[model samples]
Target: MYSGIGDHGERAAFLDARALIGCRHRLLLDSTHPRVLTGVSEDAGVQQRREAAAAHRMLVRDTLVAADPERWLVIAPEQTAAQRAAETMAAMEAGIERIWGGLLPQELDTGRRGGCEILRRDPDRGGYVPIIVVNHKVTDPRQPDPADFHPLTTELYTWNPKPDKHVRNRPQPRDQQRLAHLYRMLQRHGYASPALVGGAIGYHFDRVLLHDLGPILDDYDRRYADRIAVVRGELPTVPSKVPECRQCPWWSRAPEEGGQSCEQWLVGRRDISLVAPGSRAEVLRRHGVETIDDLAAWEGDDPDDWQYEPFTEAIVTARAWATGAPLVRRVDRVQVTRADVEVDVDLESYQEHGAYLWGTLLDGVYRGFVTWDPLPTRDEGRSFAEFWSWLMEIRAQAAADGKTFAAYCYSRTAEDKWLYESARRFAGMPGIPTEREIQRFVDSPQWVDMFQAVSEQFICPNGKGLKKIAPVAGFSWRDPEAGGEASMSWYRLAVAYEGGEPDLSQRTRILEYNEDDVLATQVLRDWMTDRADAEVPAISDFGRRSIAE
Candidate 1:
């Protein structure tokens, strides 16, 4: 019956179940169709309840008739003193034969064969009919005692409060009225009683209803003893109030003070002042000079007489005053500056093979030795010898001046391979510098200091290799877009060489390209040093501010 009204797919199995039981039955369906069930009735609530009762009655009558056809007349409803009649049914014999009934396909499977056979067969003639009821509704937890045999009803009721009348408009009054009505109905008919009454009551009536209802329900328990039981759903708990209610909007309106609102009180508040260039504000903003800005301003070239403790004291005092909400300390600012220096530089390139020198040239000085090897061999390459000689001369000049000789190549592969191979070839050479000495020469302290100072002063947008330090020193260069006409990669040069002959023209082209690279590097280096000198004050100021922060 459930399958017939619930889903169309189970219709076949439902019919088979009915056939197996050898009895006709009517499906008592719940009419959820709103239009037919709910019409223009003034008391629609009461009418709906009646429909539910009618449906239950029809289902009970049908199930009792199906249990035993011969006993149907004996159990049929008879006329009573009242206008409406009530029905009474006789129980059918059971021990004759038990017939199992279930949705088919599943009940007819091999595992269920025995149960299906029992459902089809008749019971013993003098036995009581066995009743099997299947309900899919969620069971109410607060129900009658499991040991009781009487039927019970569990219902969910809702009530909405109104404003005018506190007594009648509240949830308790309505709930009590509903409960009283149900109790009377149960008393009129000796059928069964409710084991429990449980549901969420409105919050407004909680205090009033709980005080009265909790005791009333408990009294029902005491009176009924084992006959019936009554239980009510638990009320929800409320949270505690926070102590920081002064900052909460729910407490009150805005304050009279002319400042930020309560919501903005947590945000930071500070005052800033703009003064002269060498004033307290400006000096405190220097890169290295933290606290006292003009620590070395009055000392000039003499490093002595510049007490560092006074500057430290000034900084500590200023910070304390600022933290106290109103700043107080102030000082006289003095400006000290450095002069710009220009250094001359030149780029030189050479080509050599084995022990014999081939070609050499200096940037802007075209008239120089340009030797070459007519016979080209892997072991007798002119480029290698020339590179070795050039490196030795550059290192000697760098050592005398206490400066580092930096080489800037176009790409990582080219520069890395040249450095590695040159070091390997000169490992045992008579005039070559050892690996450690060469590394020390490259890592000069003066160069490191200069580079670090300049890098912190400005931004480098087109930074790459040795050119990254250029923009920071206020110098700029024109670097060709990568892979463009002026740009060259080792792979491209190698491809050209692989297809060419070992002639003078090819060697000349290679030498010219290498020389051009050296010249560019020299020009960039000179430009960087000059720019760095001119931008020293700005760089120093930036450095000091960074330290203070």
Candidate 2:
């Protein structure tokens, strides 16, 4: 579901487990429509993640096999679906302790067929259950009393047996939902364990995450029914703009290129979803505000007493989108925090790996501290320490000159996370700041998040991302394809992430991208301070104009 995957050249013969978690429009397209490859290619970050997950699964399988070779039945990828199912069934019938990479028998009634990462026989319940191995981290040591299971044995424990393991507050809903789907498939084949539970082995492969299947199955049933309804024409298969559109194969090029893209279709209709999310668009449609033009022309007064607090904000955003304005002011006067000695900062990293590049812009000069080594290496600390030292020197010099100082980033969340993380990870290293020092700097007024300022002071119709908003400030990256995703792709080539000869030119490309990012932040901050009040239309202007109309 997350990957937007389906069979090519055929109407969906079966709904996979992913169908329980992803976009409905995507599912419908994948089910009913022939595949159309577009400009949306998988970025290096996604490819790296997929490879990492595959590696983790192999490591776990190897570890299990090394411990007890006889108790495991490993299904070969070379086997056809029929062959896999037969082999899996034979293993289950023989009470094999574990079946690695098993393809479950298809359920003819529901048309659901999929492969399971691991199918473990239950000693207590007399049948098999599903266990998934994933790349993402499932839990952290933030809270107590997490549901834990033995990584190798698949024995579950409600409380954490280890002190440094806890359940994350945020749930992994996709993992749970997929497990529920697989559990139903197991039940159909009459091989489901009566225990009503499933397991997930995440990036931290030391333990398995145990999930109770009771509530998860209930939710899965509802989602599966809805998807099946949409497939059977019991529901509308209307396309809406969603975050998932980025990964969808059915999504095509711009409408002006004579391509039949979902985005182009929405643009032609001036669809509400073009300016608002799917849920919000549905709400506006219910109120008879069906298009961006209609929304822009709407008065603040609600005829039906909907009491929607965001009604005026939505209308203003629509107006901005319709008029092709970068932003419409949500406040009376634009306010931006500025300083005499200002620095714009940007960091580049490869996926969830350590930050390898720290680019800074100060006094019309760009400086970059970068490491060429592949990530998750000791060398990351050297670059991080050098960047920190340089930044501190600038800050101290400014203080000595009696100049007020401020460091700016488009978004502080990423920078702040890496700042503390780097400090902690390399505490004993030369020139590395302590966590306390990092916290003091982050908490001080000198650290400013320009993204927060923009979000608070303006209504950005398109997006609040630096790439989107920086252009409004007359700033553009030299690289036409400059973006975080593009930078990750460049970083991979620059560092030889997958064991090939490194492309040194890609390193130059990444530095240029990082420089542009920091420059964009600086440009955006300057625009907010010097020109935003005179240039952007305020909310009051809309109100007065509406009264005149």
Candidate 3:
């Protein structure tokens, strides 16, 4: 099984654990068009995440080694994969308790080569189990359960384990499948642990989150097999529009060998995937409706035959796309909730660290409640409290004067999440409101989500994002490069998260970006109220069909 084990050599970095979780077309590109993938550089956000994850792995390794100095062996990065694998084998044979940064022998049969963050020697099984340390949370604090874990030792409490673990109800398929990949490699090298389980040390290094590999083995096998097929040209790589396309390296780059970019290829063919959900698009393709033109021109009455219901919206969107229209009004007359006193609000955070800035616009004047301190700081509460208190005061004053009052945000998801989170985290802090008060404010009709309003009354052919829709309302940001992703990079620089002199200019840029965001919501609400009827085309004008339930 180990013959020519390292012949696959160093596997491309792109084909790592993410290949199983990310877009398959990207995997194919990584194998065949590696030059194209390499041409694309990592953005600031991606860089920040990579750094944070690396830092987390180091911390976990250090903690484990500190606890049991004699038992832990760390494989040096300077060695070749074969040398590291041999060293790892010797350590395992010698019965080392834990191995850090140990590269496993390649699974040449599948062209898989990689290393685990830590290979924990299973005392009962006589082999090592893989453990990955990541920056993101694996468990949900919101849904607490009896967790079974060894906090300081970073081991799983298997038998008679305490039921104190709170597993995230949401599936973390990426992490699970990754463990399966490593498990397969271990098996190939005759290092397979009898216990078909792996662990992940997430942001809350309080305990290792254990996962049984049995359930995900079949799934991982299928995904890996299919990806290998595509890589070997046994299967074709078909490009389809997906949410991941937004971050895909090949999304816009034209191949040096002369071929249309992924974006160009999709748009040129007027691919149905561009205008419809992936599942719906696949169903549409099976029904001989492969392109947006086919979808727009399709006149079939019973969409039930296509095996996907409620297909009217996609058809309408395709028609709008064909007509070069940004949006089509669903309602005969667009309406917006108006108030004598109103505030447009926007929040900015530094990549899950915490919300650091709350920008609000009222009466054409912008007031920014900002924390200059780095995030995950107690000062986040100060900024949030200041913003909330000021807004509440405005509402109270408006009520005292018998004037209607409302607060508008582009989307309530991000804002509402942070609001409740801040209240809960800073419960006892001065100026912080109770969770109930935050809920009351969010639940109230006066808290308007303009994005929801837009969704209810319009069919945006392009997209419904603030940046995408705001231009239609005659609103634009002062900074040419202003965007949510761009702001992540700016925030990193502004705060100097990677250790450097903080760039004050980036702070100014972030403030301007936030101001524009609030201003966009204000203008959008105004546009929907005053000019939507005249400016936006009615859905009825586009040969509207009956929508199925």
Candidate 4:
């Protein structure tokens, strides 16, 4: 059991007990059930990641045991070997040493100094650099900095699900802001060693860090002094209308069964985000307005005021929340092109890898193209090609028959972004469409973004995401924990080829998730069409192929 331990897997930088209080305090404080930290879900994706973490820890422990079998006798005598391995890895993952120095690794001498989980000794800098492992590709990295981390750190290490694939070398601007602070802190502390970043793409090492520790580190000290307040929760914990709030654990159901929800306490406080993100919410708050009723009292029927739309939405949402009903505002109708035969599309992608699955619904059946191989390969291109050909063929058939056809995606920006990016990466592939074709298709009236469509017509109270909109439209996912985050976890499991080949059940869950995503769009379309002045019925022929109920 010990000799054949597998490699430690890639997980998010913060996923333990310490991080809950340190970096993510706002979310944790809002959580009604603290047990969410340890509750195990039956979600296939969650289970897959849990398995990966355990396997990776076992591998690391095996390596430690193999190196010095007798070392643990002195290092951890009271606990069994298994207990020591698990606890140590947990400590390493959480950077507990920065807080408590008791459980430092005895065998690894040069590592785990100055706050970073030691990757290795830095030959160039003479001191160690901190390492951070993220679950996805380094694209659009958004993380709060650890102010308590050691100042001697240089470039932090980061890797994704497909570590072997180097999607891009540049860290995001926000990350650069963080690295700048870390570098400056080290210099200010008189460590003065140049910081660098390196990570493994399989066995291959890439000097992936781009920010120069020298120029950027100059102002880190002054900035970091100010930085502590931003993360320290100096600002009031008021709920905003941001998308992240919709998925925050604070709003999640109680961690334990049959307990109160984290969001239950704030039942009457209205979301100030209805107006917008900036000065508008402040204005509303200043007027002693904390609920939709306040907005109604202050509102006037001024033709020129931009607040009209917001006021209208607040009223509708307020009534629905109070009465346990759904309300659709009729004044704000949007013009969305519709056809008898329409394609409902949804794309499932991992930031580390390009779009891997494209699920489409047409002719009353769900047609999906799943790319199993890693990115920058022909595997993803095949999915694009297969979907495009079938879509164009049916579209031509509809054109000849004098019937209209169109494509409707829940979020236009998401689907269009993936389509264009995939075209750019796999331009030379035979099955894929050209960038020009994709651009033309996007511009065409046949392509509809349901998000924009919904926003133009009605203002939803809860959120505008498919998870909220689809349920109201009478669509539900076939599987539990059928969220984007959960799907990514499932994807990792679906593609696992190391310990054992993936079985049918693993792949089936992923397919079902994608299929459900596309079907939800169909439901939304039909609902909207029904609400339109003239009804256009969507296809009733949900194809023969269906996800297991």
Q: Best candidate per lDDT, number? A: 3
Model 3, residue pairs in steric clash: 146-163, 146-164, 146-165, 147-163, 147-164, 147-165
Q: What are the Cα lDDT values of the candidates?
A: 0.29, 0.79, 0.80, 0.52
Candidate 4 local lDDT, residue 135: 34
* Predicted candidate 1 versus true structure: per-residue lDDT over 141-224, tens digit per residue: 223344543222211111221121212222333243223322322233331123222221222112112112333544443332
Q: Candidate 2 at 420: error in angstroms? A: 3.0
Off by over 4 Å in 1: 1-382, 394-417, 425-434, 444-457, 465-496, 502-513, 532-549
What lDDT is reached at residue 411 by model 3? 80
- Cα displacement (angstroms), candidate 3, residue 467, comes to 0.6
Candidate 4 lands at a TM-score of 0.61
By lDDT, the candidates rank as 3, 2, 4, 1
TM-score of each: 0.25, 0.88, 0.90, 0.61
Best by TM-score: 3
RMSD in order of candidates: 35.8, 4.3, 4.1, 12.2
Misplaced by over 4 Å in model 4 are 1-174, 192-248, 253-261, 268-283, 300-327, 330-335, 373-377, 532-549
- Candidate 4 residue lDDT tens string, 1-549: 001122254221111112212223244343323446455444454455555544543444454346555433212436754555455445434433221111222112111112222233344445333333323234322233444221221222322112322233434434444444333333343432354442211111222333344554445434443333333334334444444444455455554567544355345354444433334555556666565545544445422334545454554454444434443544434356689789988888864357888888886898887788754367888888887778878889999999998988987887888888778778888777888899998999889888888777665656678888888767888897788877776666677644466555767998888888888888777777665433321112111112121
Off by over 4 Å in 3: 1-15, 37-40, 124-126, 143-162, 165-167, 301-309, 544-549
Each candidate's clash count: 24, 1, 6, 3
lDDT of 2 by residue, 255-362 (tens): 234556787778888988888865777777888977888877886566454444467777778877877777888877788888899999999977667899999999
For candidate 3, write residues 43-114 as lDDT tens digits.
656777888788778888888788777877999989987899889888877878788998876555566767
- lDDT of model 2 at position 422: 95
